[model samples]
Target: MYLKHFGLSELPFRITPDTSFVFANRQHQEALNTLLMALQEGEGFIKITGEVGSGKTLLCRRLLQSLGNEWSTAYLPNPSLDPDTLFLAIAEELGVKDAVGLDHFHLVRRINRALLDVARAKKRVVVCIDEVQAMPLPTLEALRLLSNLETEKRKLVQIVLFGQPELDERLRRPEIRQLLQRITFHCRLQGVEKLEIGNYVEHRLRVGGYRGDALFTPGALRALFRASSGMPRLINILAHKAMLSAFGEGVGRIDVKHIRLASKDTEGAKSLRWFWF
Candidate 1:
């Protein structure tokens, strides 16, 4: 709605994990480097956790994009599948045409055969599971078994888990301790700092093709940092709304009043207390 007013080719602050709007902040860049390096080293299990909107999916997409043709990838955006269904899903992803209606044993056989075929081709396969905290315990165990597939040198299926903190809690259960121990590398995504917040807003605007004078004043930006707790998704939401609020008042630039209104009007903004600075 503010596209024309902002001179933007597209909506810059959408909630979807759009790689086009990915900002290369220091933490995010470091996480990506670590992820790429871990994958290259054939680490069997890598876990990346983040608060609900700390750009986990965005980074996951970036990882997929950075991998080359030698890498075959299967993505499970929803991790609610049971063990049988999960195995079948991976089998289907690896092009197991006869995997339909297969039981767990049959599915595992099919998937292993596929992985062996790829191993023969000297290509690595990565399985990325998002929202893994929602996965059933049995399903996670099945994933652990899947990760056990390997060549003489390295794993055949590299598993990257993108999930919220609940996944960690679940992994700590006694039954799943072995699975947790298998995780070689892990990191939690956090909100940017206040200074980085300023760079962040500008980064998204520029990425969205905005070419204009300064849009947000210093006071407005500072207010945004406080209200959003420096979370990128919350910052994006508040920023977009502030721009619209400014447009509504026909203000040439966003001000404290506009940001205040945005913070008040956004659904969850009023609930944040002094827990975050």
Candidate 2:
């Protein structure tokens, strides 16, 4: 609503994972580089864990978008499926018929055949599961089995799991410890650090075409770092509200007062008040 008022081409603080607005702050860069390097090494299974709203989904999407033409990706946003259902989801993604009705045996053959077809056509498939913490134990086992698809030289189906810390905890289970051991690469994503908060805000603003001078003052940005605790989602939430607060008063820059007001009105801001991002 305030895009024009702020002379922005798009909403700078949107909650969605728009890769164009991805800020390559230290931790984000490290996480991406870690995953990219691991994938290039033909790792069979990789898991990336982060706190909720810490940009795992965004990173996953960015990875999918940036992958080379030799790569094809199947994304599973909801993984709370039974083993048979999980295969069905993969089959459906690969455009197989009777995905749900087939017995587990048929489902596996179908999925494996489809994957082989893709490989023969020269496209390696990567199955990326988001919120993998919700995946049933058998489903995870099924996923591990899927990773077993490989050519003589390299893996056919590489899996990338992006999820909250709970997913790591889930992988540590006794029954799933074997699956955890199958993970060839793992990376943990940390939130934006306080030093990067202001730059991050500015980067997003510029990406959204905010041509004005600094929209947030030094102190206000510091306060925001605290109130958001370096979490990108919360930072965007606070920054968006701070801008609105400033706009309401017909101002161009956000000060601490504006941040404080924005914090008071924002959910989860209270918990972060004790620590700066």
Candidate 3:
């Protein structure tokens, strides 16, 4: 709604994980680097954990986009499937069309054949599972067994897990200890630091095609950082609402008052203790 008023080509704060709007903030860049290195090393399992709204999905998308053609990627955005269905999903992703009607044991063979075909092409296969905390424990063990498929040289497929902290708790369970042990690399995503909030806002604004002068005043930026607690999603929500409030008042710049109102209006940011004042 404030695009024209702010001289922006599009809404900069949409929650969708668009890689084009990805900001290479320190945490994100490092996560991507770690993923690349682990995958290159042919590591069997990689785990990345972050709090809700900490940009895990965005990082996942950016990593998928950055991977070269040498890597074949299978993405499982929803991990609610049972082990049997999970196998079929991977089969479908790997282009095993005939796996749909096959039984569980037969489906595993089908997937193994597909992986071998991919290996013969000198390409690596990567399976990325998001929200893995929701996946059942049996399915997770199945994933571990699937990871056991390997040639003498390296693993046949690598798995990357993108999830919230609950996934860590799940991994700690005695039944899933083997899967946890197989994870060769791990990275934790954190909120932007206080010092980086300004740059973070400017980065997203520029990436979203804001070409005009500063839209948010210094005081407003500081307010935003406090209100959002440096979480990217909360930052986006507060910033968007702040801009909308400014636009509604026919103002050209956002000030502290606008940020305060924006923070109060946002359900998530309202949980910040100072907002109750």
Candidate 4:
């Protein structure tokens, strides 16, 4: 709605994970480096945990995009399935043929065969499972078992888990200690820093096709950082709504009042009544 008004070709703050809009802040870059290093080292399992809006999914997508042609990737965005179904999903993603009707044993054999084929081709396989905290204990064990599929020198398949903070708590359970032990590398993602908010906003705006002067005033930026607590998702939400508010008022620039209105209208955004210049 505010595209033409803000001189933007597209909405800058859509919550969906678009790699083009990635800010590459300190936390995200460090996490990405850790993941790449772990994958290169042939680590068995790697875990990334963050608060709900801390850009885990975006980083996951960015990792997938950064991978070279030598990698065979399987992305499981939904992990709510049972153990059998989980294996089937991985098998299907790996291009295992005739996997739909196979029993659990047969399916595992087929998946192992496919992974071996990939290994023989001198390529690596990576399985990224998002929202993994919701996965059942048995299913997680099944995942550990899948990780057991390896060659003499290195793992045949590397598993990367992207999930909320609850995933850490779930991993502490005795039922899945074996799986926890397998996580050779882990990283905790945090919110955007206060200093980075300005550049972050500007970066997203530039990617969204804004070629005009700064659209958010200094006071608006302060109010946004306070309201969003530096979480990228909340920043996007408040910033988008603030732009819409400015647009509705026939204004080209956003101010503190716009952010106040956006915060009030947004869930999980902090109140800014005590935030003064």
Candidate 5:
């Protein structure tokens, strides 16, 4: 609603993970580098964990976009499924023909064959499973088994799991210790640091096609950092609302009062009163 008022071509702070607007803050850049390095090195399994709204989904999407034609990627946004269903999902993602009504054994075979075909074409397969903490133990085991497909030289498929911190707790269980051991590389994502918040906001605004003066005042940026605690998603939510608040008052730049109003209306945003004194 405030795009024209703010001189922005599009919404700068939509909650959805848009790769185009991704800010390469230190934490996220390091995580992306770790993922790329691990995959290039032929690691069989990799794990990434972060808190709620920590941009795991965005990172996963960014990784998928970064891979070149040499890589075949299968993305499972929701992996909370039974073992049979999980296998079928993987098969479908890998473009296995007639994968719809197959029995468990046949489904596994088809997925294996698809992985082999990709390997024969001199390309690697990477399966990215988001929200992996919600995956059933049996389904995770099935995932591990799927990773067992390999040639004499290297594995045919590599799996990358993106999830919340609970994923670590789930991997700690005795039944899944084997999978834990197979995670050759792991990275934890942190919120944007306090110092980087300004650059982050500016970067998103530039990506969203803003070409005017700084839309958020310094005080507003400080208020936003404290209110969001540097979490990207929370920052986006509070920033968007703060912009709307400023626009409603016929203002061009956001100030502390705007951020205060935003925090009041947002559910998880931290209260500004505690930081005011």
Candidate 6:
């Protein structure tokens, strides 16, 4: 609503996981580099863990887009499926049109064939599962078994899991320890650091097509960092609200008062009043 008022072409502070707005901050860049290197090595199972709103989904999408040609990617954003449904979803993603009603045996057979077909074309297939903590234990075991389908040289299908810290706890179970061991590469993602908050906001603002001077004052920037505690999603929330607060007052630049008002209205941000005072 305030895009024109702020001389922006798009919403700068949206919480959606759009890759175009992906800030190449330290943590995000490190995580992406790690993932790309591991995949290039043809690692079978890779794990990426981060806290909620830490940008795992966005990272996953960015990785998929970066794979370019020579790689076929399948994304499962929701990992709550049962073992049977999970297999069916993989099969469908691999181009098996009739994956819905197939039995477990048929589903596995189809997925295996699909993987081999992709490999024959000299292209690697990667399956990315998001929110993997919600996947059933049986489904995870099935996933491990699926990873076993491979040629003598390298695995036919590689899997990358993006999830919250609970996924690490889930991997500690006795039944799932084997799966944990299969993770050839693992990376943990952290939120934006305080010192990088200004760059982060400016980066997104530039991506959103703002060519004007600094939109947020120094005091507002400090308040924003303290209020969000370095978390990306929270920063977006607070920043968006602060911009709205500024727009309401017919101001172009966000000030400390606007951030304080935004923080007061946000759930976790209220405790940041100490920062304001």
| Candidate number with greatest TM-score | 4
Ranking by lDDT: 4, 5, 6, 3, 1, 2
| TM-score: the better of candidates 4 and 6 | 4
Candidate 2, after superposition: displacement of residue 72 in Å? 1.5
- lDDT by residue (165-221, candidate 3, tens digit) is 999999999998999999989999997877788788887889879977887888888
Candidate 4's displacement at residue 170, Å, is 0.7
Error of 6 at 169 (Å): 0.5
Q: For candidate 3, what is the TM-score?
A: 0.96
CA lDDT of each candidate? 0.86, 0.86, 0.89, 0.93, 0.92, 0.90
Q: Comparing 1 and 2 by TM-score, which wins?
A: 1
lDDT of 4 at 39: 97
For candidate 4, the lDDT comes to: 0.93
TM-score of 6: 0.96
lDDT by residue (tens digit), candidate 4, 24-122: 999999999999999999999999999889999999999999999999999999999999999999988998769998889998999999999999999
Superposed model 1: Cα runs more than 4 Å off = 270-277
lDDT per residue, candidate 5, 1-277, as tens digits?
Answer: 9999988899999999999899999999999999999999999999999988889999999999999999999999988899998888888888887888888888888888888899889999999999999999999888888888899999989999999999999999999889999999999998899899999999999998899888888888999999998899999999999998888999898889999999999888899986762
* TM-score of every candidate: 0.95, 0.94, 0.96, 0.98, 0.97, 0.96
- C-alpha RMSD by candidate, in order: 2.2, 2.0, 1.8, 0.8, 1.1, 1.3
How high is the lDDT of residue 243 in model 6? Answer: 94
Please identify which of the two predictions, 4 or 5, would achieve the higher TM-score against the true structure. Answer: 4
Error of 2 at 10 (Å): 1.7
Q: Can you write out model 6's per-residue Cα lDDT over 41-150, one digit (the tens) per residue?
A: 99999999998888999999999999979999899999999999888888878888877787888888888888888999989999999999999999999999999999
lDDT of 6 at 213: 98
